[model samples]
Target: MTAAHCTFFGESNPETVQSMQGCMRKLKLMVPKLRVQKRVKELEFIQHVIEYIRDLELILSEDESYTPHSTQISPISPHLDSTYRP
Candidate 1:
């Protein structure tokens, strides 16, 4: 009895097997770093939102006539650029 293996790259080739194994190892290492970077971005976005809210609160408290169209730019202004009028 014999076992058969098939791949686009020849299955019996040691070089192909080692190259694939190296690629897999590199991908495994990158996955966690990618996750950490994604999480860091999320935290940064949350921080920006918090700061924007704080600025809004300060403006509202300082001026009874505060409006969304006021001159002050937000920390998250890029997101508001499309919807904000002023």
Candidate 2:
């Protein structure tokens, strides 16, 4: 979980950070739906998995904040915002 050598997220940028925030908001909104699972064991596992993913996200964010990403690769096009869908 070193800040300078993140292996999971690869890189960060304005668009990528924005998208991740948006997706996280959407996932939180879906938590209630997860509570309706008929099997308790399955529900617990699903919740654990989601928590694990969120933990990774936290690590990624912290890494980006504490390290320099100026040399990292970014796929976002500065010219595509006007036509981009997501």
Candidate 3:
């Protein structure tokens, strides 16, 4: 039996970078569900994904040489409040 592991490569290609940036921009446009705070699990999941995407954006922005698409890295807008208790 053989074990498998997943690996992630930092994409430096101009076209792929542009596509990823576009997808991230589109993700930011998503609207939260009505009364999302009521759903604790869903809210937590959303927060986790948002944090991950922000981390990815930070990595992309740090590579100044790969900016064939756009040099501007806009922060994702906050759709949910940080201090919400269920």
Name the best candidate (by TM-score). 3
- lDDT agreement with native, every candidate: 0.46, 0.48, 0.48
lDDT (Cα, tens digit) per residue for candidate 1, span 6-86: 232546477767666565444333233332332345455445445545654665577677676789764633433233221
Clash list (residue pairs), candidate 1? none
Evaluation by TM-score, superior candidate among 2 and 3: 3
lDDT of 3: 0.48
Tens digit of lDDT per residue, candidate 2, span 1-86?
23333222865877766666565444444444333444445456556447645754555566655455467765634433232221
Question: In model 1, where is the ten-residue run with the lowest total lDDT?
Answer: 1-10
* C-alpha TM-scores of all predictions: 0.30, 0.30, 0.33
- For model 2, state the Cα shift of residue 28 in Å: 0.4
Kindly report which residue stretches of model 3 are placed more than 4 angstroms away from their true locations once superposed: 1-40, 68-86
Q: Which lDDT value does model 1 have at 41? A: 57
The CA-based lDDT of model 2 is what? 0.48
Clashes of each: 0, 0, 0
